[model samples]
Target: AIQIAASRDQLDPLLLSQAPGISFKYWKDATQLYLQQIDRLVAKGEDAKLAENKPYGGPVFRKMAVQLSLHDLKGAVTTLVDARLFQEAYVLSRTRYMDSLAEQTLRLWAHDCFLNGHYNTSSVCYMALGDLSQAAAALGKSSDEESLSLAADIAKVLGQTTFAGHIEEKREFIKSKKELLEKLDKQVEDQDLKDLPSRSELVIKENNTEKSQLEEPEKDTENAKEVASTDEKNLMSDTQAEESGKGEDENKIEKLLVELPEKMEGLLKDGIQNGMHKGDGDTMQNGEATDPQNNNEILAKPLQNGSEPVQEKSATE
Candidate 1:
């Protein structure tokens, strides 16, 4: 009921009195309500005199209320810190004199910011606490080269020579690392370029090999064709020579056949003449008169039978 009334901004003196008891259990809620009420009253230009004239009257009551409110606010700030709400806790605590609580909250907030990589925020927090060294160190965590270099210059101006030198050294290291990576990349590109011609040559050699492999059968076929043509030519020449030799042999045989009858007739005539001479000599020795007609018949009979003429015998034999 009290929380409901607080939320509605309808909390009376009766509910406000119960807030102290609520602080023991729900201190953060109670503190928040009390601070809101205080803010409202201040905004309305309410003074201590107006506060005292209310049902919660008297200076003693006012003082006790202030003390209790302070205690509750402190508890609320501690709760926020425990919840890792350091920024809220720091802001809440810084508005009042919470003794060492504000400084503790600022430190916690700075550390949280640093861990979360809010380097600039952490550096501001550290600077607010008058910690120049920690502030410069926080700024050094930034990735920007120009920011790091600027931070180094700022650190030097602020009399933090050691931190400035560290920042400068880190900046140089980052630059050198980047340069080295660029050089390595360039070298890899150059190597790839250098290998391109050899790779092309290898491709050409492979193509030539494949072409030769494909043409080998054709070359073999051409050689076979040449051999076949040469064989055909040789066979043709041999046939022509054989035909020519046969023609010459036929001519020689035909010539011999054509002259054969003439040669036989001349040999027959010589044999007949010798037979007549022999017959005349024999007739003279025998003293017989030669019958020319009978000799002629004898010669004619041999000629008719195609035989050589026989010599005439003596009349005594």
Candidate 2:
């Protein structure tokens, strides 16, 4: 009847009570046999379909239950750990006064969660393990502001002030770093805005440069022509002015030549009249005729002596 019930998947407390001679050792063996049979039948099914069915009322639970009933705490914990039910394994170990097993399970679970990026779960496991620094470090790895804040509060409540302070400092550092990045982004945007010229202005400047470049040779040629024309005009005007000036100079020289002989004859006539008047006065004062030849000889003697003749005074007394 027990074998029939185990085949029918009816391994309950009532069945065990009805069969008082059957121990948990026999029950564990029967359950494992039934699980093996179920696995063989489900082997051809898809993995999802097989996972959906709890073989033999969950192999881990059945084995753990059997081990617990047999007072085999270590076996039960081992069963839970093999099933990857770490939290339950730790709890069972702790409740059974297996301190070393509980700590070992917790550390294993924490490292597993940490390696799998389950930072919050790892943090809780580390906290349960009394490793406040690792717990805070795990929370820091989560990069969730609210989770870190909550962890800081929990740390404070647990009297882990230093870890709580470290968590707060890390949060502040992250916030400051975020603000600094935002400020740098804003500065970069502003600088880009300042450095970028308007499209129309840039186009216009490019066009102007192109047009100026294209027109330079033409403008240079026109300028050269204009300069040549101006230079020719200036040369013509300079030559005309020089010719007119030369003609005026020649006219002045001709006029001076025409007046020079007349001027010299007039000077000689004036000198002769003054000398004749002096000779008449001298003749009257001496009561004698003064000859022109003697006057000529007197003027010739003063010229030879390079001196002027002394004038004779009239006797009035």
Query: TM-score winner among the candidates?
Result: 2
Candidate 2 wrongly placed segments (more than 4 Å): 1-125, 128-130, 137-151, 159-170, 186-216, 244-248, 251-317
CA lDDT, every model vs. true structure: 0.74, 0.74
RMSD of each: 19.0, 13.0
Encode model 1's per-residue lDDT on 1-317: one tens digit a residue: 56786775555564465565535667556667867877776787863422443544444334445544556777677667777778767776777677489998999889999999999888888989998778878889987687688779879989989988989999999888989999999999998878445788999999999999999999999999999999999999999999999999999988877666556556766776686688679768877566667655655543323444455643333
The number of residue pairs in model 2 that clash at the backbone is: 0
| Candidate 2 accuracy as lDDT | 0.74
Candidate 1: C-alpha lDDT: 0.74
TM-score each candidate: 0.37, 0.39
